[model samples]
Target: MDKTPLTDPALAQLFTQARTYNSWSDRPVDDATVRQLYALVSAGPTTANSHPGRFVFIRSAAARARLRPHLSAGNVEKTMAAPCCVIVAYDTRFHEFMPQLFPSRDFSATFAGKDAVIADTAMRSSTLAGAYLILAARALGLDAGPMSGFDKDTLEAEFFPDGRWKANFLCNIGYGTDDQLFPRNPRLAFEQACLDL
Candidate 1:
Protein backbone atom coordinates (compact mmCIF):
# COMPACT_ATOMS: atom_id res chain seq x y z
CA MET A 1 0.00 0.00 0.00
CA ASP A 2 1.22 3.48 -0.85
CA LYS A 3 1.63 5.93 2.01
CA THR A 4 0.31 9.45 1.71
CA PRO A 5 2.67 12.39 2.18
CA LEU A 6 2.59 14.29 5.46
CA THR A 7 1.95 17.41 3.40
CA ASP A 8 -1.08 15.88 1.70
CA PRO A 9 -3.98 18.31 1.79
CA ALA A 10 -6.38 15.84 3.39
CA LEU A 11 -3.91 14.80 6.06
CA ALA A 12 -3.07 18.41 6.86
CA GLN A 13 -6.74 19.22 7.22
CA LEU A 14 -7.36 16.22 9.45
CA PHE A 15 -4.67 17.44 11.87
CA THR A 16 -5.98 20.99 11.89
CA GLN A 17 -9.66 20.04 11.92
CA ALA A 18 -9.47 17.90 15.03
CA ARG A 19 -10.91 19.91 17.90
CA THR A 20 -12.70 19.48 21.20
CA TYR A 21 -16.29 19.80 20.14
CA ASN A 22 -18.70 21.00 22.80
CA SER A 23 -21.85 20.74 20.64
CA TRP A 24 -22.93 18.12 18.19
CA SER A 25 -25.47 17.59 15.44
CA ASP A 26 -28.67 15.64 16.18
CA ARG A 27 -27.20 12.66 14.33
CA PRO A 28 -26.58 9.38 16.13
CA VAL A 29 -23.35 7.36 16.25
CA ASP A 30 -23.88 3.69 15.46
CA ASP A 31 -22.56 0.84 17.58
CA ALA A 32 -20.32 -0.33 14.77
CA THR A 33 -18.48 2.98 14.85
CA VAL A 34 -17.85 2.61 18.55
CA ARG A 35 -16.49 -0.91 18.09
CA GLN A 36 -14.27 0.24 15.26
CA LEU A 37 -12.84 2.99 17.43
CA TYR A 38 -12.01 0.47 20.15
CA ALA A 39 -10.41 -1.91 17.70
CA LEU A 40 -8.22 0.88 16.44
CA VAL A 41 -7.26 2.18 19.88
CA SER A 42 -6.49 -1.22 21.38
CA ALA A 43 -3.51 -1.53 19.06
CA GLY A 44 -1.80 1.45 20.71
CA PRO A 45 1.01 0.75 23.16
CA THR A 46 0.63 0.15 26.90
CA THR A 47 2.90 -0.68 29.81
CA ALA A 48 3.95 -4.34 29.42
CA ASN A 49 1.09 -4.51 26.92
CA SER A 50 -1.21 -4.92 29.94
CA HIS A 51 -4.03 -3.10 28.10
CA PRO A 52 -5.59 -1.83 31.32
CA GLY A 53 -8.20 0.43 29.80
CA ARG A 54 -11.86 -0.52 29.51
CA PHE A 55 -14.59 1.47 27.86
CA VAL A 56 -18.34 1.51 28.51
CA PHE A 57 -20.18 3.41 25.82
CA ILE A 58 -23.54 4.96 26.61
CA ARG A 59 -25.74 5.77 23.63
CA SER A 60 -29.25 4.91 24.68
CA ALA A 61 -31.38 7.46 26.45
CA ALA A 62 -31.70 5.10 29.39
CA ALA A 63 -27.95 4.76 29.85
CA ARG A 64 -27.39 8.47 29.34
CA ALA A 65 -30.13 9.10 31.91
CA ARG A 66 -28.15 7.06 34.42
CA LEU A 67 -25.13 9.24 33.74
CA ARG A 68 -26.98 12.55 33.98
CA PRO A 69 -27.07 13.07 37.72
CA HIS A 70 -23.37 12.30 38.01
CA LEU A 71 -22.33 15.03 35.62
CA SER A 72 -21.76 18.63 36.66
CA ALA A 73 -24.45 21.09 35.61
CA GLY A 74 -22.07 22.57 33.02
CA ASN A 75 -21.61 19.16 31.39
CA VAL A 76 -25.18 17.84 31.61
CA GLU A 77 -26.63 19.51 28.52
CA LYS A 78 -23.73 18.84 26.15
CA THR A 79 -23.40 15.26 27.32
CA MET A 80 -27.08 14.63 26.76
CA ALA A 81 -26.93 16.26 23.35
CA ALA A 82 -24.01 14.09 22.23
CA PRO A 83 -24.71 11.09 20.08
CA CYS A 84 -22.59 8.88 22.32
CA CYS A 85 -20.70 9.17 25.59
CA VAL A 86 -17.81 6.90 26.53
CA ILE A 87 -16.84 6.06 30.08
CA VAL A 88 -13.12 5.42 29.97
CA ALA A 89 -12.29 3.27 32.95
CA TYR A 90 -9.43 1.19 34.29
CA ASP A 91 -9.50 -2.30 35.71
CA THR A 92 -8.03 -2.57 39.18
CA ARG A 93 -7.16 -6.16 38.42
CA PHE A 94 -5.70 -5.61 34.98
CA HIS A 95 -2.76 -7.85 35.82
CA GLU A 96 -5.02 -10.90 35.45
CA PHE A 97 -5.16 -10.25 31.76
CA MET A 98 -1.37 -10.13 31.43
CA PRO A 99 -1.07 -13.84 30.75
CA GLN A 100 -3.31 -13.59 27.73
CA LEU A 101 -2.54 -10.02 26.66
CA PHE A 102 1.16 -9.78 27.39
CA PRO A 103 1.86 -13.49 26.69
CA SER A 104 5.65 -13.07 26.72
CA ARG A 105 6.08 -14.13 30.34
CA ASP A 106 3.94 -14.35 33.44
CA PHE A 107 4.17 -10.82 34.86
CA SER A 108 0.84 -10.91 36.65
CA ALA A 109 2.37 -12.41 39.76
CA THR A 110 4.54 -9.32 40.19
CA PHE A 111 1.49 -7.13 40.69
CA ALA A 112 -0.37 -9.42 43.05
CA GLY A 113 -0.96 -8.00 46.57
CA LYS A 114 0.51 -4.64 45.56
CA ASP A 115 -2.32 -2.13 45.72
CA ALA A 116 -0.26 1.03 45.18
CA VAL A 117 1.56 -0.39 42.15
CA ILE A 118 -1.66 -1.70 40.67
CA ALA A 119 -3.48 1.63 40.98
CA ASP A 120 -0.59 3.60 39.54
CA THR A 121 -0.13 1.34 36.53
CA ALA A 122 -3.85 1.07 35.83
CA MET A 123 -4.49 4.84 35.87
CA ARG A 124 -1.44 5.76 33.78
CA SER A 125 -1.95 3.12 31.11
CA SER A 126 -5.69 3.69 30.87
CA THR A 127 -5.18 7.43 30.50
CA LEU A 128 -2.91 6.72 27.54
CA ALA A 129 -5.67 4.58 26.04
CA GLY A 130 -8.11 7.45 26.52
CA ALA A 131 -5.78 9.69 24.50
CA TYR A 132 -5.62 6.99 21.85
CA LEU A 133 -9.44 7.03 21.76
CA ILE A 134 -9.47 10.75 20.97
CA LEU A 135 -6.90 10.35 18.17
CA ALA A 136 -8.73 7.35 16.74
CA ALA A 137 -11.97 9.29 16.70
CA ARG A 138 -10.31 12.10 14.80
CA ALA A 139 -8.87 9.64 12.28
CA LEU A 140 -12.39 8.30 11.76
CA GLY A 141 -13.72 11.79 11.00
CA LEU A 142 -15.52 12.11 14.30
CA ASP A 143 -15.37 14.95 16.79
CA ALA A 144 -14.79 14.53 20.54
CA GLY A 145 -15.17 16.47 23.75
CA PRO A 146 -13.24 14.99 26.68
CA MET A 147 -13.72 16.44 30.15
CA SER A 148 -12.91 15.75 33.79
CA GLY A 149 -15.66 17.94 35.22
CA PHE A 150 -17.80 15.07 36.52
CA ASP A 151 -17.80 13.60 40.01
CA LYS A 152 -15.62 10.49 40.04
CA ASP A 153 -16.93 8.89 43.22
CA THR A 154 -20.53 9.45 42.21
CA LEU A 155 -19.75 8.04 38.78
CA GLU A 156 -18.05 4.94 40.17
CA ALA A 157 -20.89 4.21 42.57
CA GLU A 158 -23.53 4.77 39.93
CA PHE A 159 -21.77 2.84 37.14
CA PHE A 160 -19.07 0.61 38.55
CA PRO A 161 -19.71 -0.35 42.18
CA ASP A 162 -18.19 -3.83 41.86
CA GLY A 163 -14.76 -2.37 42.89
CA ARG A 164 -13.18 -3.87 39.77
CA TRP A 165 -13.62 -0.83 37.57
CA LYS A 166 -12.40 2.73 38.24
CA ALA A 167 -13.48 5.72 36.22
CA ASN A 168 -10.78 7.71 34.38
CA PHE A 169 -12.63 10.30 32.31
CA LEU A 170 -15.71 10.88 30.15
CA CYS A 171 -15.69 11.75 26.46
CA ASN A 172 -18.61 12.79 24.30
CA ILE A 173 -18.38 11.87 20.62
CA GLY A 174 -20.29 12.87 17.47
CA TYR A 175 -20.48 15.17 14.49
CA GLY A 176 -19.34 18.56 15.75
CA THR A 177 -20.68 22.03 15.10
CA ASP A 178 -18.24 24.83 14.24
CA ASP A 179 -20.39 27.35 16.05
CA GLN A 180 -19.49 25.74 19.34
CA LEU A 181 -15.75 26.01 18.85
CA PHE A 182 -13.56 28.78 20.23
CA PRO A 183 -10.68 30.19 18.23
CA ARG A 184 -7.55 28.09 18.24
CA ASN A 185 -5.44 28.49 21.36
CA PRO A 186 -1.66 28.85 21.61
CA ARG A 187 0.55 25.85 22.17
CA LEU A 188 4.11 25.69 23.41
CA ALA A 189 6.73 25.30 20.70
CA PHE A 190 8.63 22.01 20.49
CA GLU A 191 11.85 23.62 21.66
CA GLN A 192 10.09 25.00 24.73
CA ALA A 193 8.31 21.78 25.66
CA CYS A 194 10.79 19.01 24.78
CA LEU A 195 14.29 18.11 25.94
CA ASP A 196 16.77 16.40 23.58
CA LEU A 197 18.35 14.42 26.38
Candidate 2:
Protein backbone atom coordinates (compact mmCIF):
# COMPACT_ATOMS: atom_id res chain seq x y z
CA MET A 1 0.00 0.00 0.00
CA ASP A 2 1.29 3.46 -0.90
CA LYS A 3 1.16 5.76 2.11
CA THR A 4 0.86 9.50 1.75
CA PRO A 5 3.05 11.87 3.73
CA LEU A 6 1.27 13.06 6.86
CA THR A 7 0.31 16.74 7.23
CA ASP A 8 2.53 18.57 9.70
CA PRO A 9 3.80 22.02 10.78
CA ALA A 10 5.03 22.93 7.27
CA LEU A 11 1.60 22.08 5.84
CA ALA A 12 -0.01 24.35 8.42
CA GLN A 13 2.02 27.31 7.12
CA LEU A 14 0.58 26.79 3.64
CA PHE A 15 -2.86 27.58 5.04
CA THR A 16 -1.61 30.26 7.42
CA GLN A 17 0.16 32.19 4.65
CA ALA A 18 -2.91 32.28 2.47
CA ARG A 19 -3.99 35.90 2.43
CA THR A 20 -6.30 38.10 0.38
CA TYR A 21 -4.05 39.33 -2.41
CA ASN A 22 -4.93 42.72 -3.90
CA SER A 23 -2.42 42.92 -6.71
CA TRP A 24 -1.43 40.42 -9.36
CA SER A 25 1.32 39.87 -11.89
CA ASP A 26 0.71 40.13 -15.66
CA ARG A 27 0.30 36.34 -15.96
CA PRO A 28 -3.05 35.06 -17.16
CA VAL A 29 -5.38 32.56 -15.55
CA ASP A 30 -6.69 30.39 -18.36
CA ASP A 31 -10.24 29.04 -18.68
CA ALA A 32 -9.04 25.54 -17.84
CA THR A 33 -7.64 26.70 -14.50
CA VAL A 34 -10.86 28.48 -13.59
CA ARG A 35 -12.92 25.40 -14.44
CA GLN A 36 -10.62 23.23 -12.35
CA LEU A 37 -11.06 25.56 -9.39
CA TYR A 38 -14.86 25.33 -9.75
CA ALA A 39 -14.72 21.53 -9.90
CA LEU A 40 -12.80 21.46 -6.63
CA VAL A 41 -14.98 24.01 -4.86
CA SER A 42 -18.31 22.41 -5.80
CA ALA A 43 -17.57 19.34 -3.71
CA GLY A 44 -17.58 21.36 -0.49
CA PRO A 45 -20.62 20.96 1.82
CA THR A 46 -23.69 23.14 1.96
CA THR A 47 -27.06 23.02 3.67
CA ALA A 48 -28.72 19.87 2.28
CA ASN A 49 -25.94 20.02 -0.32
CA SER A 50 -28.13 22.40 -2.30
CA HIS A 51 -25.10 23.66 -4.32
CA PRO A 52 -26.81 26.94 -5.18
CA GLY A 53 -23.74 28.98 -6.13
CA ARG A 54 -23.02 29.83 -9.77
CA PHE A 55 -19.85 31.54 -10.99
CA VAL A 56 -19.49 33.84 -14.01
CA PHE A 57 -15.85 34.36 -14.92
CA ILE A 58 -15.09 37.62 -16.70
CA ARG A 59 -11.73 37.53 -18.52
CA SER A 60 -12.28 39.56 -21.64
CA ALA A 61 -12.06 43.34 -21.79
CA ALA A 62 -15.69 43.62 -22.95
CA ALA A 63 -17.10 41.67 -20.01
CA ARG A 64 -14.87 43.59 -17.64
CA ALA A 65 -16.30 46.82 -19.10
CA ARG A 66 -19.78 45.77 -17.99
CA LEU A 67 -18.35 45.37 -14.48
CA ARG A 68 -16.49 48.70 -14.22
CA PRO A 69 -19.42 51.01 -13.57
CA HIS A 70 -20.60 48.86 -10.68
CA LEU A 71 -17.24 48.46 -8.97
CA SER A 72 -16.22 50.49 -5.97
CA ALA A 73 -13.48 53.01 -6.77
CA GLY A 74 -10.98 51.22 -4.54
CA ASN A 75 -11.53 47.87 -6.27
CA VAL A 76 -11.41 49.10 -9.86
CA GLU A 77 -7.68 49.06 -10.62
CA LYS A 78 -6.73 45.74 -9.02
CA THR A 79 -9.87 43.97 -10.20
CA MET A 80 -9.41 45.21 -13.76
CA ALA A 81 -5.76 44.18 -13.81
CA ALA A 82 -6.36 40.63 -12.60
CA PRO A 83 -6.34 37.86 -15.18
CA CYS A 84 -9.90 36.80 -14.28
CA CYS A 85 -12.59 38.19 -12.08
CA VAL A 86 -15.35 35.81 -10.99
CA ILE A 87 -18.85 37.04 -10.26
CA VAL A 88 -20.18 34.75 -7.62
CA ALA A 89 -23.96 34.59 -7.85
CA TYR A 90 -26.78 32.66 -6.26
CA ASP A 91 -29.67 31.13 -8.19
CA THR A 92 -33.03 32.29 -6.97
CA ARG A 93 -34.70 29.13 -8.29
CA PHE A 94 -32.09 26.73 -6.96
CA HIS A 95 -34.65 24.76 -4.99
CA GLU A 96 -35.86 23.20 -8.22
CA PHE A 97 -32.73 21.07 -8.22
CA MET A 98 -33.22 19.80 -4.67
CA PRO A 99 -34.85 16.59 -5.81
CA GLN A 100 -31.86 15.74 -7.95
CA LEU A 101 -29.33 17.12 -5.45
CA PHE A 102 -30.75 16.14 -2.07
CA PRO A 103 -32.65 13.07 -3.42
CA SER A 104 -34.25 11.81 -0.23
CA ARG A 105 -37.37 13.93 -0.69
CA ASP A 106 -38.65 16.63 -3.02
CA PHE A 107 -37.85 19.84 -1.14
CA SER A 108 -38.37 22.17 -4.06
CA ALA A 109 -42.02 22.75 -3.28
CA THR A 110 -41.14 24.21 0.11
CA PHE A 111 -39.31 27.12 -1.52
CA ALA A 112 -40.94 27.22 -4.97
CA GLY A 113 -43.39 29.98 -4.13
CA LYS A 114 -41.65 31.65 -1.23
CA ASP A 115 -39.48 34.48 -2.54
CA ALA A 116 -38.04 35.67 0.79
CA VAL A 117 -37.19 32.21 2.04
CA ILE A 118 -35.71 31.25 -1.29
CA ALA A 119 -33.52 34.34 -1.42
CA ASP A 120 -32.36 33.84 2.16
CA THR A 121 -31.42 30.20 1.70
CA ALA A 122 -29.77 30.69 -1.69
CA MET A 123 -27.67 33.65 -0.54
CA ARG A 124 -26.47 31.93 2.63
CA SER A 125 -25.56 28.69 0.91
CA SER A 126 -23.87 30.38 -2.04
CA THR A 127 -21.80 32.64 0.20
CA LEU A 128 -20.47 29.54 1.94
CA ALA A 129 -19.60 28.06 -1.45
CA GLY A 130 -17.82 31.25 -2.46
CA ALA A 131 -15.60 30.96 0.60
CA TYR A 132 -14.85 27.42 -0.43
CA LEU A 133 -13.78 28.71 -3.82
CA ILE A 134 -11.24 31.01 -2.19
CA LEU A 135 -9.76 28.24 -0.06
CA ALA A 136 -9.66 25.83 -2.98
CA ALA A 137 -7.86 28.42 -5.08
CA ARG A 138 -5.26 28.84 -2.35
CA ALA A 139 -4.79 25.08 -2.13
CA LEU A 140 -4.24 25.02 -5.88
CA GLY A 141 -1.41 27.58 -5.58
CA LEU A 142 -3.41 30.55 -6.84
CA ASP A 143 -3.81 33.94 -5.20
CA ALA A 144 -7.31 35.29 -4.58
CA GLY A 145 -8.82 38.63 -3.71
CA PRO A 146 -12.46 38.39 -2.62
CA MET A 147 -14.33 41.65 -2.37
CA SER A 148 -17.87 42.88 -1.61
CA GLY A 149 -17.55 46.42 -2.90
CA PHE A 150 -19.67 46.20 -6.02
CA ASP A 151 -23.17 47.56 -6.57
CA LYS A 152 -25.36 44.48 -6.41
CA ASP A 153 -28.44 45.97 -8.10
CA THR A 154 -26.49 47.31 -11.03
CA LEU A 155 -24.45 44.13 -11.29
CA GLU A 156 -27.55 41.95 -11.36
CA ALA A 157 -29.21 44.12 -13.98
CA GLU A 158 -26.12 44.23 -16.17
CA PHE A 159 -25.07 40.58 -15.87
CA PHE A 160 -28.20 38.62 -15.00
CA PRO A 161 -31.21 40.59 -16.21
CA ASP A 162 -33.66 37.65 -16.17
CA GLY A 163 -33.68 37.68 -12.33
CA ARG A 164 -32.49 34.10 -12.08
CA TRP A 165 -29.06 34.99 -10.66
CA LYS A 166 -28.35 37.43 -7.84
CA ALA A 167 -24.87 38.83 -7.38
CA ASN A 168 -23.13 37.86 -4.13
CA PHE A 169 -19.42 38.79 -4.29
CA LEU A 170 -16.46 39.11 -6.64
CA CYS A 171 -13.08 37.38 -6.57
CA ASN A 172 -10.04 38.31 -8.60
CA ILE A 173 -7.64 35.43 -9.24
CA GLY A 174 -4.12 35.23 -10.64
CA TYR A 175 -0.45 35.19 -9.68
CA GLY A 176 0.18 37.82 -7.01
CA THR A 177 2.85 40.52 -6.82
CA ASP A 178 5.06 40.94 -3.79
CA ASP A 179 5.08 44.72 -4.13
CA GLN A 180 1.34 44.78 -3.43
CA LEU A 181 1.40 43.04 -0.08
CA PHE A 182 0.99 44.92 3.15
CA PRO A 183 2.76 43.91 6.34
CA ARG A 184 1.18 40.82 7.84
CA ASN A 185 -1.41 41.71 10.42
CA PRO A 186 -1.69 40.15 13.85
CA ARG A 187 -4.29 37.54 14.67
CA LEU A 188 -6.03 36.76 17.93
CA ALA A 189 -4.70 33.81 19.91
CA PHE A 190 -6.99 30.81 20.40
CA GLU A 191 -7.64 31.71 24.03
CA GLN A 192 -8.64 35.22 23.05
CA ALA A 193 -10.73 34.29 20.05
CA CYS A 194 -12.44 31.05 21.12
CA LEU A 195 -14.34 29.99 24.22
CA ASP A 196 -14.95 26.41 25.35
CA LEU A 197 -18.44 25.69 26.56
Candidate 3:
Protein backbone atom coordinates (compact mmCIF):
# COMPACT_ATOMS: atom_id res chain seq x y z
CA MET A 1 0.00 0.00 0.00
CA ASP A 2 1.07 3.61 -0.45
CA LYS A 3 2.37 5.40 2.61
CA THR A 4 -0.66 7.64 2.26
CA PRO A 5 -3.83 6.09 0.90
CA LEU A 6 -6.26 7.95 -1.32
CA THR A 7 -8.40 10.48 0.53
CA ASP A 8 -11.63 9.09 1.98
CA PRO A 9 -13.77 11.31 -0.22
CA ALA A 10 -11.95 10.15 -3.34
CA LEU A 11 -12.31 6.54 -2.30
CA ALA A 12 -16.02 6.97 -1.72
CA GLN A 13 -16.52 8.64 -5.07
CA LEU A 14 -14.92 5.74 -6.91
CA PHE A 15 -16.23 2.85 -4.83
CA THR A 16 -18.80 3.15 -2.05
CA GLN A 17 -20.72 6.08 -3.47
CA ALA A 18 -20.72 4.66 -6.96
CA ARG A 19 -23.87 2.91 -8.13
CA THR A 20 -24.64 0.90 -11.24
CA TYR A 21 -27.13 3.33 -12.70
CA ASN A 22 -30.27 2.44 -14.60
CA SER A 23 -31.22 6.02 -15.45
CA TRP A 24 -29.11 8.81 -16.83
CA SER A 25 -29.34 12.59 -16.78
CA ASP A 26 -29.46 14.53 -20.05
CA ARG A 27 -25.88 15.69 -19.64
CA PRO A 28 -23.67 14.49 -22.47
CA VAL A 29 -20.24 12.88 -22.30
CA ASP A 30 -17.95 14.46 -24.87
CA ASP A 31 -15.54 12.63 -27.16
CA ALA A 32 -12.50 14.17 -25.46
CA THR A 33 -13.61 12.86 -22.09
CA VAL A 34 -14.09 9.37 -23.45
CA ARG A 35 -10.74 9.51 -25.16
CA GLN A 36 -9.10 10.58 -21.92
CA LEU A 37 -10.89 7.73 -20.16
CA TYR A 38 -9.39 5.27 -22.65
CA ALA A 39 -5.92 6.67 -22.19
CA LEU A 40 -6.24 6.18 -18.47
CA VAL A 41 -7.63 2.67 -18.82
CA SER A 42 -5.00 1.48 -21.28
CA ALA A 43 -2.24 2.27 -18.83
CA GLY A 44 -3.46 -0.37 -16.40
CA PRO A 45 -1.57 -3.68 -16.22
CA THR A 46 -2.37 -6.62 -18.48
CA THR A 47 -0.83 -9.98 -19.31
CA ALA A 48 2.25 -9.25 -21.46
CA ASN A 49 0.58 -5.90 -22.08
CA SER A 50 -1.44 -7.76 -24.69
CA HIS A 51 -3.82 -4.78 -24.53
CA PRO A 52 -6.52 -6.78 -26.27
CA GLY A 53 -9.41 -4.62 -25.18
CA ARG A 54 -11.19 -2.51 -27.79
CA PHE A 55 -14.13 -0.16 -27.32
CA VAL A 56 -17.00 1.11 -29.45
CA PHE A 57 -18.56 4.21 -27.99
CA ILE A 58 -22.16 4.26 -29.10
CA ARG A 59 -23.25 7.88 -29.04
CA SER A 60 -25.47 8.45 -32.04
CA ALA A 61 -29.18 7.69 -32.11
CA ALA A 62 -28.68 5.31 -35.00
CA ALA A 63 -25.98 3.36 -33.19
CA ARG A 64 -28.08 3.07 -30.09
CA ALA A 65 -31.05 2.00 -32.19
CA ARG A 66 -28.93 -0.73 -33.74
CA LEU A 67 -27.75 -1.90 -30.33
CA ARG A 68 -31.27 -2.05 -28.85
CA PRO A 69 -32.32 -5.17 -30.68
CA HIS A 70 -29.44 -7.08 -29.11
CA LEU A 71 -30.06 -6.04 -25.52
CA SER A 72 -32.19 -8.00 -23.12
CA ALA A 73 -35.62 -6.59 -22.28
CA GLY A 74 -34.37 -5.52 -18.87
CA ASN A 75 -31.42 -3.66 -20.36
CA VAL A 76 -32.73 -2.04 -23.55
CA GLU A 77 -34.58 1.00 -22.21
CA LYS A 78 -31.90 2.01 -19.73
CA THR A 79 -29.06 1.38 -22.15
CA MET A 80 -30.73 3.28 -24.95
CA ALA A 81 -31.55 6.20 -22.68
CA ALA A 82 -27.96 6.67 -21.54
CA PRO A 83 -25.79 9.22 -23.30
CA CYS A 84 -23.35 6.58 -24.53
CA CYS A 85 -22.77 2.87 -24.28
CA VAL A 86 -19.26 1.51 -24.65
CA ILE A 87 -18.95 -1.85 -26.32
CA VAL A 88 -15.96 -3.44 -24.60
CA ALA A 89 -14.46 -6.05 -26.86
CA TYR A 90 -11.29 -8.01 -27.64
CA ASP A 91 -9.30 -8.52 -30.83
CA THR A 92 -8.71 -12.17 -31.61
CA ARG A 93 -5.38 -11.21 -33.13
CA PHE A 94 -4.16 -9.30 -30.09
CA HIS A 95 -1.01 -11.39 -30.04
CA GLU A 96 0.06 -9.72 -33.27
CA PHE A 97 1.19 -6.84 -31.12
CA MET A 98 3.22 -8.91 -28.70
CA PRO A 99 6.39 -8.41 -30.75
CA GLN A 100 5.93 -4.66 -30.50
CA LEU A 101 4.67 -4.49 -26.91
CA PHE A 102 6.80 -7.22 -25.34
CA PRO A 103 9.91 -7.27 -27.44
CA SER A 104 12.08 -8.44 -24.56
CA ARG A 105 10.87 -12.03 -25.19
CA ASP A 106 8.95 -11.47 -28.44
CA PHE A 107 6.61 -14.43 -28.16
CA SER A 108 4.10 -13.25 -30.74
CA ALA A 109 4.76 -16.17 -33.07
CA THR A 110 4.23 -18.71 -30.30
CA PHE A 111 0.96 -17.07 -29.25
CA ALA A 112 -0.32 -16.73 -32.80
CA GLY A 113 -0.42 -20.48 -33.31
CA LYS A 114 -2.10 -21.37 -29.98
CA ASP A 115 -5.83 -20.95 -30.38
CA ALA A 116 -6.80 -22.00 -26.83
CA VAL A 117 -4.22 -19.74 -25.24
CA ILE A 118 -5.30 -16.86 -27.42
CA ALA A 119 -8.93 -17.28 -26.47
CA ASP A 120 -8.19 -17.47 -22.76
CA THR A 121 -5.83 -14.55 -22.78
CA ALA A 122 -8.17 -12.39 -24.80
CA MET A 123 -11.13 -13.10 -22.54
CA ARG A 124 -9.29 -12.59 -19.27
CA SER A 125 -7.27 -9.55 -20.26
CA SER A 126 -10.14 -7.84 -22.05
CA THR A 127 -12.45 -8.35 -19.06
CA LEU A 128 -9.85 -6.85 -16.76
CA ALA A 129 -9.39 -3.96 -19.14
CA GLY A 130 -13.14 -3.38 -19.13
CA ALA A 131 -13.07 -3.21 -15.34
CA TYR A 132 -10.22 -0.72 -15.58
CA LEU A 133 -12.36 1.45 -17.85
CA ILE A 134 -15.16 1.43 -15.29
CA LEU A 135 -12.82 2.58 -12.56
CA ALA A 136 -11.24 5.12 -14.85
CA ALA A 137 -14.66 6.55 -15.68
CA ARG A 138 -15.53 7.01 -12.00
CA ALA A 139 -12.14 8.56 -11.35
CA LEU A 140 -12.96 11.06 -14.09
CA GLY A 141 -16.30 12.07 -12.47
CA LEU A 142 -18.53 9.94 -14.69
CA ASP A 143 -20.83 7.09 -13.66
CA ALA A 144 -20.79 3.69 -15.36
CA GLY A 145 -23.35 0.93 -15.69
CA PRO A 146 -21.64 -2.28 -16.86
CA MET A 147 -23.87 -5.03 -18.16
CA SER A 148 -23.52 -8.46 -19.76
CA GLY A 149 -27.18 -8.85 -20.57
CA PHE A 150 -26.98 -8.66 -24.31
CA ASP A 151 -26.89 -11.19 -27.12
CA LYS A 152 -23.19 -11.33 -27.92
CA ASP A 153 -23.56 -12.86 -31.35
CA THR A 154 -25.99 -10.23 -32.51
CA LEU A 155 -23.84 -7.40 -31.20
CA GLU A 156 -20.78 -8.79 -32.93
CA ALA A 157 -22.59 -9.34 -36.22
CA GLU A 158 -24.00 -5.84 -36.15
CA PHE A 159 -20.84 -4.07 -34.97
CA PHE A 160 -17.80 -6.17 -35.78
CA PRO A 161 -18.50 -7.20 -39.37
CA ASP A 162 -14.89 -8.24 -40.00
CA GLY A 163 -15.20 -10.97 -37.31
CA ARG A 164 -11.86 -10.10 -35.73
CA TRP A 165 -13.26 -8.21 -32.74
CA LYS A 166 -15.71 -9.79 -30.30
CA ALA A 167 -17.87 -8.14 -27.68
CA ASN A 168 -17.12 -8.90 -24.01
CA PHE A 169 -19.69 -6.61 -22.41
CA LEU A 170 -21.39 -3.19 -22.50
CA CYS A 171 -21.19 -0.21 -20.20
CA ASN A 172 -23.37 2.86 -20.32
CA ILE A 173 -21.77 6.14 -19.37
CA GLY A 174 -23.27 9.44 -18.17
CA TYR A 175 -24.44 11.37 -15.15
CA GLY A 176 -27.03 9.37 -13.25
CA THR A 177 -30.45 9.85 -11.66
CA ASP A 178 -30.81 8.95 -7.97
CA ASP A 179 -34.42 7.82 -8.08
CA GLN A 180 -33.51 4.99 -10.38
CA LEU A 181 -31.05 3.42 -7.97
CA PHE A 182 -32.26 0.44 -6.02
CA PRO A 183 -31.60 -0.02 -2.32
CA ARG A 184 -27.99 -0.98 -1.76
CA ASN A 185 -27.21 -4.68 -1.71
CA PRO A 186 -24.84 -6.19 0.80
CA ARG A 187 -21.55 -7.60 -0.32
CA LEU A 188 -19.92 -10.78 0.88
CA ALA A 189 -17.89 -10.60 4.07
CA PHE A 190 -14.12 -10.71 3.75
CA GLU A 191 -13.91 -14.21 5.20
CA GLN A 192 -16.56 -15.50 2.85
CA ALA A 193 -15.00 -14.07 -0.28
CA CYS A 194 -11.26 -14.16 0.53
CA LEU A 195 -8.75 -16.81 1.53
CA ASP A 196 -5.32 -16.09 2.98
CA LEU A 197 -3.55 -19.24 1.95
Any runs in candidate 3 off by more than 4 Å, and if so which?
1-3
**Going through the candidates in order, what is the number of backbone clashes in each?**
0, 0, 0
- Model 2 scores what on Cα lDDT? 0.88
TM-score of 1: 0.93
Question: Which of the two candidates, 1 or 3, achieves a greater TM-score against the reference?
Answer: 3
Ten-residue segment with the worst summed lDDT in candidate 3? 103-112
lDDT of 1 at 87: 96
What C-alpha lDDT values do all the predictions have? 0.90, 0.88, 0.92
- Compose the digit string of candidate 3's lDDT tens values, residues 41-97: 899999888899999999999999899999999998899889999999999999988
Candidate 3, lDDT over the whole model: 0.92
Clashing pairs in 3: none
**Tens digits of lDDT, candidate 2, 1-197:** 99886477435534667778889998988878888999988899987888889999999999999999999999999999998899999998888889889898878667878988888889999999999888777777788899999999999999999999989999998888877888879999999999999
Worst 10 residues of 1 by lDDT: 8-17
